[model samples]
Target: MLSKRSVAASVLCALLATGATACNGDKGGPAAASAPASARPSASPVPTLAVDTLTADQISEQAHAAMAALASVKVDGELTMDGSKLAVHLTSDKQGNCSGTVASPEVGQFELRHSGSKTWLRADETTWKKAVAKEPGATAQDAAIAAELFKGRFITGGDTRAELAEAAMMCNLIKGLFADDSDKGKEKIAKGSAGTTNGVKTFGLTVTTGDGENLTLHVATEGKPYLIRMEQTQGSEPAAFDFSEFDKPFTVQEPAADQVVDFSVFEKKVKKA
Candidate 1:
């Protein structure tokens, strides 16, 4: 009976040791640790992009085509031209329809609603005062009166007047932005490192235009490789334009009858001032 008990105990000890060895082969199970080389999971492969291999100018041409195909987009930017810094926020289409605002130290701030041939502008008190004072022989009293009279009202007109024509042209803000002469000195274009803007991955192309302005154009890495943003960081007056809402449709409604004051009324008021 003693011999039988010893044999059974030995067998049990051997089984436990084998089980422990197999279970503790590594952090994972024995099969995983000792699996054939061909059976192991492979690392995920990185995706290849054709745009990444293209030349800087080729990439820019592609981006320009993408931008040109866009029917409408929301453009927001801080621009410096002729030593004046301006902030612009606009939702415009290729068809000359836009509703947005442009702000600057000289203009103060003004909102524009332009559709077809008509344009409506609503200027803040500072802008109203400035506009009134610009008229010939206008006094401070006139500026004050004009500012109060047109406060919170939009001045409407067709493209007949100079102010109206200029305001109406703002509907093509995107066109003016990416004009054909935008990058006249294309020979100086240099490819930049990959980065991201607003969570979208992009690669940049730095260029010095004919006007000597240094610009960095960031094009999206994925999808259609659209021009996502353009930044001017090299000059004394830094500026940036962020493009979004591609191909989105927007509408600009005419101001309410009571809220609108005709441009003739504004002109008469300024003349009296």
Candidate 2:
């Protein structure tokens, strides 16, 4: 039998897991039995989920379907690639619209926004200085001038620069993030026990990849059974990502004309230097 303290701790964990209120805080009692029927609180109807009875692979497929059905999603996580660490907080849609900040040790941090064929990039003085200094035959004077010219302004342009194109690809949540991993041809899928992610009750589906990496996907237990979080262990470094704001409406507004500079001008300046 669990002690009172243990029971209270479990209740607290459930209530605070998702950072949302999970219980009414009313202690169990018999007083409601004497109250009128109308005075009693209506019980919440239990949600019926088709994936509950399915195999682990089937549940993963359902979770992927739910994620694919969303119009947009917010992804926040850090990943390591080739020994370099990258952090990103992005909101992307299937229509190629995205707005987010990506940071890394090499390139510092930058804010990006994309809509249609236009893209806008903003960075601090140090980032601009480093970028300009990388150009062939660029001098310190040229780097300083580049930094001053682009400071406190956005570098806006079409999909002409390869670097910009790669950054903009982060907005493809459906193709890039919600991709079907079953085609990898070397993953073993298994069901995990019930758990909670950010306070939302979830059940996990763990996939052991060909490279011996373990990727655990957490699917919400309530409502639509949407994916709540994903955790991947690659060697010794672990990367975890949280998914939220599913199907929420968001607008990616272009920067004001006065606060923008064309990339062509910057490129020309650097080349002439």
Candidate 3:
């Protein structure tokens, strides 16, 4: 009902009323004024990482990653490689603090307590006697040497660099001996299966080396994927390692003055004798 000029005027009036920069003439709709890029609300970033089911091999790798992040861990293991048949139960921290016992068929049991820069070692009386024996028939001199080593009591292991290194390396040695080696992961022969051990859930996988060595790793699944257990066959016996206490702090306090028999006193005594 309106002339072309009248229609054009109406459209312009409508646009002006609405404050539109442009309206449908060639353009289809009112164009929204763009905000400054800095003022614009940004869309949240999409997560690139995905959570999915993991394979046994994959789980083992993740468990290792978890262990590497830990400050301390509890270890209960039976080691057979050195004929020590060493039964170890301990809590080890990377900063040179630990409390544990290393027992063997030959050496009986040695209580190990390391704190700060000092390591204290005390073998059971029977083990001490056997250690000092040196031979089936021990000379008085051998007995004296044994007494000198212990000063008839707890001995400090921090006197020498090698001794300190040995004390420091003890925790790492136990970790290496029991924990699954990541390098052996690729050779895992079978896929891991979900199973439970001792009422706990786990993801378990087995791997072997080129030389026919085989080992199995079990990773906990209910919570964080942690390496819960490991098994390896050595000769006819199967050695086992159980891991727990991921983040708990283990404290090793110094023995009482009377309880501690410093090795230096024994060294001095032996030098005088």
Candidate 4:
């Protein structure tokens, strides 16, 4: 039999596994008081990167740096988790503006949008129930609201940068592969033969993570060497990601005031009930 702590650990892992979609940041219990937060844009000119005649590490490093300068980006891909597929789609701006949906095998399709630390979410009743059940001290009223009031509607919350980043990373073909503290030798970052995908001529750059996660990017060769496609090894099979809409505009419409419910309402109702 599993001990209580083991079970709790298992549950926590399961909840976190929904990263890039699952709620994070002070989300375990009765919703905390939410203060306004915004993902303001970084005030800097778009960095001009040298992408020509670069090595695999250069490609990755350049791509990570360029990603921040991107005013907006659209990313879509598959994420493999515990042998199941979590398909996701996202569009985000550098200022933390994000809008996307993740279709999880466990909880069905859930959509979330964010402006800075403020987030609005739309999901089915089951997803909401699963979300609140993970809360540290969620009450019966919380469950009721999750089922009736917040069901099938957009609900706002605080601390959304991490959540938005997770949503973006769900489709982020490049990030964390060469995290600051981890390192792999030159052998892992290699150049492969030229190829084409969907009529886009490209060369391949592959980086193997410290934990054995493999990332491969097919970059456009003719023009600016834009990242056209990405593939990552998940389990035995590789998950594919397609990148587009670089530096474009992305807007996540807020739910109408009448249609939205914030956590403060939940706190008041739960306490009174």
Candidate 5:
């Protein structure tokens, strides 16, 4: 019924009205309502630790008790170090024996006896006399080296006093015999499954030192914490002790009253070239 020009004008006006409505919606209408949902903040993904639930005093008490339990144990085991393998036995109570060959790549043979408080370092007769004359003290350093030499020549002079000190500290640390309780850190030694070696149920504890050394101490009984094995892997050297034999009826004797320990034997004097 309408002419072609009138029909084209009607369609153009309708399109312009629709575009204006769309523009207005974008500026401040339903489009703005949808924007807030996208811009809203997301939930956090980080996990939280429950450390706030524990106090420092509680941690210290736990650590001390654990160490005390460790110190009260006695153990005997085989010891291997520096390519030399030996039968190692130790008793925290009073007496034990370690008898083994020092091996090749080193010189000598050894049979060391420790009864009561006395330790006899019996070396290949040739080396024993040499050491008795060279080193003359009873300090831990001298005693450790002497113990090694008694078994053979696998030890060297460069083994520093610091190394001996560290060994002693490690031994005492496990025993909870710190000179100052404050020296102990807030690290707890954890207990693992019960293991049995030689028909004895052994309890295990693993401790990591401040310097990052990992050591495992195994005790054979709960009431009596006799050490059955010790494994250490901290530095370049891996050290361990395995208790293979136990003699319950063996007579335990004490060192003589007049016997003297010369710690000075561990001191090294520099000689002028």
Candidate 6:
């Protein structure tokens, strides 16, 4: 027979071995399987975009379209040229017509008219008669030159009658030009709180031309930018043009034969003199 002390020691050892096996089984089963679940990361949230933000391309297109619309509208305004205030007016149907007058301080007054495809100028009755006597079927170029002479200041060199027509086209083209995509070298000039002009909230945008000219545009609440002003420097003198009284109605009429002057006649006379 075994002794009592030995019997007790044997029983204690058996109990300890069973308890260790139970603990190991619990860890290897459910506890081990759940370790990865606790270590894994959660999903991230999505980002939001602002309402007022616009891309550069979008801004350019908006500007261009605004200019185009302005060109399509009837325009009438006053122009101050060389200390003389002149009335400027334009009207366009499906076809187009434009005319204006410049009353100079020193030089006498002159007028310009365009009808259908014809352009004419009346510079006092004497010059008109002289011009008609010289060239009967004179070109639009002749008419523009006569108009410039009547104003006492001529258009710049390389500025032909065709060029003047192009300039007139610009009044309409400005709408589309601003809507074009921005080129690689160009950059946004200004953006922020806009001020009010004539009860209209207006934002200003300034762009530097490739030829180093600085052009400024004023955009209204309707997302259209009108060429309100432009500045250029020649040596020490600075020249500028300001636009106002926009979106008003005005009448543009065609010139009569008696009012038209042929500039070729005046040119030949100047050469002879």
Count of steric clashes across candidates, in order: 0, 4, 0, 4, 16, 7
Rank by lDDT (best first): 2, 1, 4, 3, 6, 5
lDDT of 3 by residue, 119-162 (tens): 77776556655554434333455445554456436666345534
Best by TM-score: 2
Relative to the true structure, candidate 5 reaches a TM of 0.37
The runs of at least 3 residues in candidate 3 whose Cα sits more than 4 Å from the true structure, single-residue gaps closed, are 1-52, 135-141, 144-152, 159-161, 173-186, 210-212, 234-237, 271-273
Q: Which ten contiguous residues of candidate 1 have the minimum total lDDT?
A: 27-36
Note each model's CA RMSD in angstroms.
Answer: 30.8, 17.5, 32.9, 9.7, 35.2, 39.9
Locate the minimum summed-lDDT window of 10 residues in model 4. 27-36
Q: Rate the local accuracy (lDDT) of all candidates.
A: 0.61, 0.62, 0.53, 0.54, 0.34, 0.36
lDDT of 1 by residue, 178-212 (tens): 54454444447889988776556678898766666
State residue 214's C-alpha deviation in candidate 6, in Å.
2.9
> What residue runs in model 4 are displaced by over 4 Å at the alpha carbon?
1-17, 20-68, 129-144, 159-187, 234-238, 267-273
Clashing pairs in 2: 17-198, 17-199, 18-198, 18-199
**Per-model TM against the reference:** 0.75, 0.76, 0.68, 0.65, 0.37, 0.45
Q: For model 1, how many clashes?
A: 0
State, as a TM-score between 0 and 1, how close model 3 is to the true structure: 0.68
After superposing candidate 1 on the true structure, give the runs of residues whose Cα lies further than 4 Å from its correct spot.
Answer: 1-49, 134-136, 179-187
Scored by Cα lDDT, where does model 2 land? Answer: 0.62
Off by over 4 Å in 2: 1-52, 133-138, 179-186
A best-first ranking of the candidates according to their TM-score comes to: 2, 1, 3, 4, 6, 5
lDDT tens digits by residue: candidate 5, 47-148: 321223434334334434543443222233323333333332233321122222221112333333333333333345344333333332223333344444
Q: lDDT tens string, model 6, 69-132?
A: 5433433333333333333333333234555542323233444444455544444634432332
